[model samples]
Each structure stands twice: as C-alpha cells, then as structure tokens.
Target: MIISSAEIDSAVVALAPVMRRTPVVASRVLSEQLSADVWLKCENLQRTGSFKPRGAYLRISRLDDEQRSRGVVAASAGNHAQGVAWSATQLGIASRVYMPVGASIPKISATRSYGAEVILQGETVDEALTAAHAHAEESGAVLIHPFDHPDIVAGQATVGTEIIEQVPDVDAIVVPLGGGGLLAGIAAAAAVHRPDTRVIGVQAAGAAAWPGSLQAGEPTPVGTMDTMADGIAVARPGAVPFAHVSELVDDVVTVSEEAISTALLLMVERAKLVVEPAGAAAVAAVMSGQVDVSGRVCVVLSGGNIDPLLLTHVTTHGLSAAGRYLTVTATISDSPGGLMEFLALLRDLGASVVDVTHSRVAGSLRLGEVQVTVSAETRGPDHQSEVREALAQAGFLRS
Candidate 1:
C-alpha cells in the first residue's frame, strides 16, 4: 500500500481544522555550534503536547459509522493514549487506553481527562499493546493502533508536508522514532516533495529497534527495552511503518541516556521548551554528533508531556551529565567550626552549595571525625574539576 502525496495532501486538508500549524524556529545556539543552519520543528507545542494526535485523530476519524459507534481502543507509552482519547471525545465516541504500569503520571492523567477509561497494565508499551488487543477483541472496540495503519501514517505524514512547506530549503530532518510512524510519515513526505531532503530517525539507545530491523529488511522484535524516554520505548518495529522507513528513511541512529538528558536540559535552558526525553532524542543525536548532519537541518521536538517529577530528575541528571552539578564527600571534624570551614572552602572555590548532609556515624568514621556530603552547582566541567582539586588540596576530600 503506497502512501502517496495525494493521500497526505488530503489528510492535510482533512486535519487543518483540528491540528495546529506548528512552528519552525531557528536554533541560534545550535547553528553556531554545529556551524550549520539548524532549525527546530516545534511539534512539542501541538495539541495534546505532542504530534501523536495527528495520527490518532486522523485514524479515528476515518472509521466507519459502526466502528465509531463501537468506539476506539489503544495502547501507548503516554502521548498516543492521550491523542486517541482526545480524538474519540471530539468524535463523540467512547475510548479506552492502556498504558504501561510506570507510565508518566501527567500523561495518564491527561488521557483520562480527555475522556478515556484508562487502564494501567504491563511494564512496556508492547505489553500494554497486548492488553489493548485483547480488549479490542473482546469488547468489539475498534483498535486504533498508535502506528501501523495507512491512515495513521497518512495523518502523521502531514507533519512532513508541513515541514517542506515551512522550510523550503531544508537539507535534513531528524525525528524521534519508536514504531516509526512519525519517521516513516516524514520520510514519505520527503520522498514525494523533496526527495533529496535527508530524513533521519533518532531512537533512545536502550530502546532502538530500527537498526536491527532495517538490517533484516523486515519488522523485528527485541526481547527487552529499558529507557527513561518511555515515550519511545517500543520493543518492535510496526510492520506498516517498517515498510516506509526501511525503504524511505535515510538513516536511523541511537542516542545515549546521558546525551538525551543533556539534550533535554539544553532544550529547557536554551530553547525554553519543555520537552520529554523522547522529544529531545533527535537533539541528543545532533548534540552527541551521532548523526552526521550539516546544512539547513531541522529536528522535530515530538512531545512535551512529561511528569514534573521526571522533569526534575532529568534536569538534575542533565546537569550532572553536562558537568554543571556535582556531589562530593569530605571528612570534617565533628565540631562546630567544621561545617563552617568546609562551606567556606566551597565558597572560595566559587561552587554554590545546593545541599549538605552531615553524618557522625558513617562507615569507618573516627570518633572525633564527621562525614559531610555536599552537592554543589558549578559553572561547567572545568569549574567542577577545579572545585574538586581545591577540596582535595584542603585535605577534606574523601577519595
């Protein structure tokens, strides 16, 4: 089933009333660093805080009268669940979504708020999908797959079509990939309108399935996936998306956990964009230099539906990864002046203390001696090393 530009064009026309024409913004910092024109496709600002609704809404809207009456069901890491639920509500059809047991709290809540019966099941999206399939079979609800359907792909392809229209001179597009709906859709659009425009897929290193699947020339399933970017943690490549991606996508690459966190931090600090880890994956790829890119490159920020707690953790991790945060242990005297002197040392080193813990009874501590653990904020990597070196020289550093 070839998904032609005509189908995508029709999807664009059909979805115009519902979907936002997301913006394309230039990344000054990234352009300066990479020495190329870098742009960001802010799909993170799309309805439901993601690009999922494009596919989900289009897929659900296409169902016949009987299917609509019976309702829709789906499984997602988080974003797609909300998309389907919101779309179902808009169409006045019932909806149910199954999300992984540890899915982001905000995403789950948003899905329910969109009027879906939410069930928390399984440890991964693939496992949740199993339950969704069973529900569709037993309850007769039409299964609205997160990907893996012609209509879904066609819907997502609107993003690509928009990208071409938004950046007529774009040289490359980097996308966050899970089951490949977004990547494949964009690749198809590029193939039709701008064949020479490179389409790259970025995946969380722990959950990447495309590299293996593309090598095999078929949809391939992996045994396990572990990543903080739960939104892109799928175990297998969907067959429908695989066909388009395998044939059309220029490259598929993975980004490390640290790199993803760093990218998320950069987006928050530099771009003022609140994006989930999966949403930052493409930027991670670019920042980590995993994918060779130059010229006018654009990366899609796919979603922004992240739990606040997760955002805190990712930001802290990103700080650590970027060497802007540090934790150090030092043995100080179990005396009043001990903490004051130790803090003074940190102040002199220009490290702003974030937190401090003093322990009197820790492993092998002498009777008069105490242990102090300090977490500090620093300027950058070199400053972190300088702080450590200063502490070590003062004979307070442990190790």
Candidate 2:
C-alpha cells in the first residue's frame, strides 16, 4: 500500500497517547556558525531512549486480537529490539527478540528486562533476522520487522509530522539512513506538504550504501560494514524506502567515523545533549561539511543508547580534537629539582597537568636522563603550543 502524508498523520495521531511528543530544541551555537536556524528533534529522549518505540508500538497496536494473542517476534542489533520488547510488554503480548551476539550488553539486558524472551543469535542482523523468521514460522508468531513493513514506515513518519509542527518553516530535514524506515517516512510527509523544503539523508561513510543505491535506482547492499553508528549501518535500503528515498530525498551524503565521534561529543559538551553515534549521524554530516545546509535545518537525533565505554572514548576524542588535552614526552636532567622545574614550566605556561608518567627506560633516554610523559589540559591548541614551547626553552627537549 502507498503510505501518504495523510496515513502518516493518522499514524501520528494514533500514537499520540502512547508515544511521547519528543521536544525540539534550538541549536544556538550551530545556528550561529552555520548561518541558519538549526533545530534538533530530541527523539533520543523518547521511550526506550529512541524513536523506534513509536513505530514498534504503533505497528504492534495495529495487530488484531488473534495476532496479539499469538505474540510477535523481531530481529535487531539493538535499539529496535528494545523498542519491540518494551512495546510488546506494554500491550501484554508475548514477544521474542533476536539480537546479534555482539550486540551491546545494555541493549541485551534492557530487552530481557522488558519482559521479552531475548535470543542471542548469529553475527549480524541479517543472520538474526533469518533465525527470527524461522522461529516465527515454527511458533505461529507474527514477525515485526525493524523497518520493512508498511505500518512501520507510516509509524516512523510521525517524526516528520512532529518536525513540521514543531518547526513549521523548516527549510531542510537531515535524517540518518539505515534501512530507511525513518528517512522514507520523513520524505513522504515532507515531499507532499513541505514540497519546497529539502530532505537530505545521511549515512556513515563506513556503510555508504544509499549513495550507490540512489545512483543505481535500486537497493544495493554493501559487502561489509564498519562504523560506530550501528543504527544506520544497514547494508542496503528497503524496497519501499528505496523508492521514496530515490524520489523524495534531495541529497544523500556520507560522514566519517571521526565526524560522528565529534558530533556526539559536541552534543554532550556544547548542546548538553547525550546522543549515540547512530543518532548523531545527521549532525555529523553537517558538522563535517559533507553537506551544505545554510538555511533553516532540522537534524533528527534518533537515539541515545551508547555504551558507557564508547561514550567515554568519544568524549576524550572530542577533547583531543579541541586541543583541550595534550600528551607529550620530555627529557629532563636527573636532578633533585628537575621534576619540579619541568612542572614549574608547565605552570608558568598556564597548563593544568592531568597525568604524569616518569621513567628511565633505556632506548628512550640516557642513564642520567629522565623521560617524563606529561598529559595536560589546556585552553586550546595555542595554549598547548605554549606549553610545548615552555618545555623546549627550559632545556627539556621533547622526547
């Protein structure tokens, strides 16, 4: 069935009572820098920490009494699994979620905690999907696909509806693409109502299948995927999504892992918003200059379920990029005040020492030379250079 703006609007209305009307926050810094009115749809704060819950709950709610009694099954890498499990549990229906073995621990635990039977299967989403289908067939359960169903597409379109209502004059909507449920939904609504408003889709450079698919005018799968943005790491787009994306999406671009990391960190530090890598892909595209969005832009922050360890790494990566953290080695004289002198120089240069490592390793330094590896936090790159120059002028050459 052809999913139109009316169907999307109806789905949004249907989901109004169940799903949260996620807020849209303006980005002052990004807007000033990009010379545009930038707004961010904070779907990351939605139920299950992602907008997937909207579509999942909407689709599950549409099932008949008999279908609901039979239960539902779905395969997902992470966010979608949690959405299905949580939605099913809320509806008092049995649910089974098949997730890849390497899926994040938090997602696995969250799915199980939501009163769903969680199955760890295969190495990829496709493999898990195959297993989920087999289980559904054998157990007489309905398979709720993550992105390939009509209900799902219509349900996800609610995001578009919310965006337009939240920011009526939005000139462009940049969405992250995985299997394209979200993108297709947004495109369908924007194409008809806000025809003048451009809709751009972004994909991780590590898994850039959309560009190739657009060129070929068909769905094309990437042989391999490697990126931190697992949410948009689909090897190819869905059939329905491919059609809409090819026709409605104005431009499809790709962003690198570094850009995604920076975007995540910036959201946390600058915007005070916690966003996962997948959810930050749209911002990644604009921040990395992969796309030119100079006018009013709305970026969809899809999810915020990043692993703690990865979040820590992204934060440090951001600090490094901003030159707020510096790691350097210096050779010092083996004297009583040598360490004090080195530290004094750093203090004089206005650098706050974060970590210091001193050693007398053989090849790295002479017997009487002390190798000091100092990590300091500075204001910016200029302050970092000032610290480096101070160490150099104090007869403590960089080791």
Candidate 3:
C-alpha cells in the first residue's frame, strides 16, 4: 500500500498525544570527529525504549470495532513485542505475544509487564511468528505484523516530521533498517517536505537484505541471518516498506560487527547515550567511513532495551575492537617473582591489568619457563602499541 504525505500527516496528529517527541540533541563528540554537525534522534528514550510503539499504536488504532473486539496477536524477539503489547493495553484490547525460546528473559518480562499474554513457542523469531499466525487464525485475532503495513510506515513517519522540524538544514538522515518501516517512513517525509535532504539506511552486514532486494527491484529474502544486533537483523525486506524505500531512499549501507560495537561504545562513552547495537548502526556507518556524505547529519538512535548481560559482553567486545582493551600471552622464567615482574612491566607501561594467568607446565614451555596470559586496558591503539613494544623489548613477549 502507498503511504502518502496526507496519511503521514494524519498519523503525526494522532500520535502526538500518545507518542513522545523524542529529543534531537547535538553530539559534540561526534561533531568534533566527523566533518559534520551531528544530531541524534534519541528514540532510545521513547516509550517502550524504542520507536516500535509509535507504529504499533497507529496500526492498532486503525482497526475497526470488530477487529478490536477480536484482540491482537504478535511475534517478536523483544522490542516489537513490548511495543504491540503496550499499544494494545493503551487501547484496552487483549493481546498475545509469541517470542522465541531463546529470546532474552528481560525482553519477555517487559512484554508481559506491558500486559501481553507471553508465549514461548519456537527457537527463532520466524518460528514464533508462524505460531502467532496460527494463533490469529484459530482465535480470530488481528495479527500485528511489524513494519509491513501502511499504517506502521505512516506511524514511523512521525519521526521524519520531527527530524525536519528539529534540524531544518539537515543534509542527510541515517536510519537503522530492519523490515524498513522506519527508513521508508522517514524517506517518505523527507520526500514530501525536504526533497534535497538525503535519507540513508544502515543495516547489519551479516543480515543485510536491502542492497540485493533494491537491485532486484523487489523484496528479497536472505538464506541465513547472523548478528548480535537483534533489533535490525531482518533477513527479508517487507513488501510495503520496499515500495517506498526503492523510490525515496538515497542510499543503503551495511556496517560490520566491529563497527557496531565500537559505535555503541562511543555513544555510551562520548555521547552518554545507552544505545543498542542496532540503534548504533547509523553511527557505525559514520565512524567506519561507510556513509560518504557529510553535512548536518542526524543519526537515529533506534532503541535501548538491551539486556544487561549483553551490554556487558558488547562493551568488552567494543573496547577490544576500539583498541582500548588487549589480551597477550608470553613466556617468562618459572621463578616465583617472574609473574610479578611481568605484571610490573605492564604497569610501568601504563596498562591496567584486568586478569592474569600463569602456568609453569605448559606443553610449549621450556623446563625453567612459564606461560603467562594477561588481559589489560589501554587508552587506544597507540597505547596498545606502546605496551606491546615495551613487552617485546623486555624479552617477555615471545613471537
């Protein structure tokens, strides 16, 4: 279905009372780094910790009395589930949500707390969605498909309206792309209001489907999906969003896992924003030199409902990727003070030790030698080099 300017305008008015006009804040750190004035559309602070609720509410609100009476059913790994559940509750409609068996406990709990009857049904989101469709058919409930309908797209367009209003001179807008509702919706608003403004879509390289689909002139599905950024790890592009994206979007780009982690790290450390990996995708594009354009750029921070465990893991990975964390192994004399002296060398080089392990009886160790492994924190790539140089010069680092 075609999503027009009028439809989006109507949705903006309808959603204003229900949805947040999330902040568009200037990022001084990002501005100093990239050759552009950068602003973040912090939808991570939106209701339900993402932009999902905006579309969910609009889609549910459009249902007729008969459809509303039948209630609604949905499937999601996390953010979308909470969004649909919260939207349904706001409208006083009964809702059921099917989530993957391995979906994060926090997300499942959040979905349930939003008043959804949570069902653990399958091993993956696709499988859970199959169960949701079955439930919808059997129970006569409305299926709230994430990002596939005009209402969802129009609902997501409200973000675009906010952007145009917030950053009137924005040269480009970057969005995290999954099913493409948010990207297409923003592109729609940009098309109608600021035709000169560029709208770029960023996807996880491991699970990207847009470049191929755009080339094929239709929605295309990928054979396999793998990514830590669960929010935008969509294997297929939705048909409805594809219609608008193929025509309106300026460019679609993919960023690597390392880039995403680093971007998330930067957002947390530099901008002080708790953004998920998917939400950091656009920033990853800028940091990794994937997005070539520059001006008053606005990167949409899509969601923030990350599991604490994941946050810990991703933070470590991010630090490592950014050269702020390091792991090294070396052979030292098997004497009692050997390990302590080795650690002293690291301390002298300004590396803060995280953990250290020593073994005297390794297969590769010489009779009077010990194998020692250490993980340390550094300032950046240069500091890492300095530490390695000092270790090697001291004859403590072997090959």
Candidates' C-alpha lDDT? 0.92, 0.88, 0.92
* lDDT accuracy of residue 55 in candidate 2: 80
Candidates in order, TM-scores: namely 0.98, 0.93, 0.98
lDDT tens digits by residue: candidate 2, 191-285: 76788889999999998888888888888888899998887888877888887887888999998887888788889988999989999999988
Error of 1 at 112 (Å): 1.1
Stretches off by above 4 angstroms in model 3 are none
For every candidate, C-alpha RMSD to the true structure in Å:
1.0, 2.1, 1.1
Deviating ranges (above 4 Å) for candidate 2: 389-399
**Tens-digit lDDT track of model 1 for 126-192:** 8899999999999999999998999999999999999999999899999999998999899999999
lDDT of 3 by residue, 1-399 (tens): 768889999999999999999999999888888868999999999999999999999999999999999999998889999999999999999999999898889999999999999999987777888899999999999999888989999999999999999999999999999989999899999998999999999999999999999999998888788889888877788999999999899999999999999999999998999988899999999889888647799999999988999999999999999999999999999887988899998988899999988887889888999898899999999999999989999998878
Per-residue lDDT value at 207 in model 2 = 88
TM-score of 1: 0.98
lDDT score for candidate 1 against the true structure: 0.92
Clashes by residue pair, model 2: none
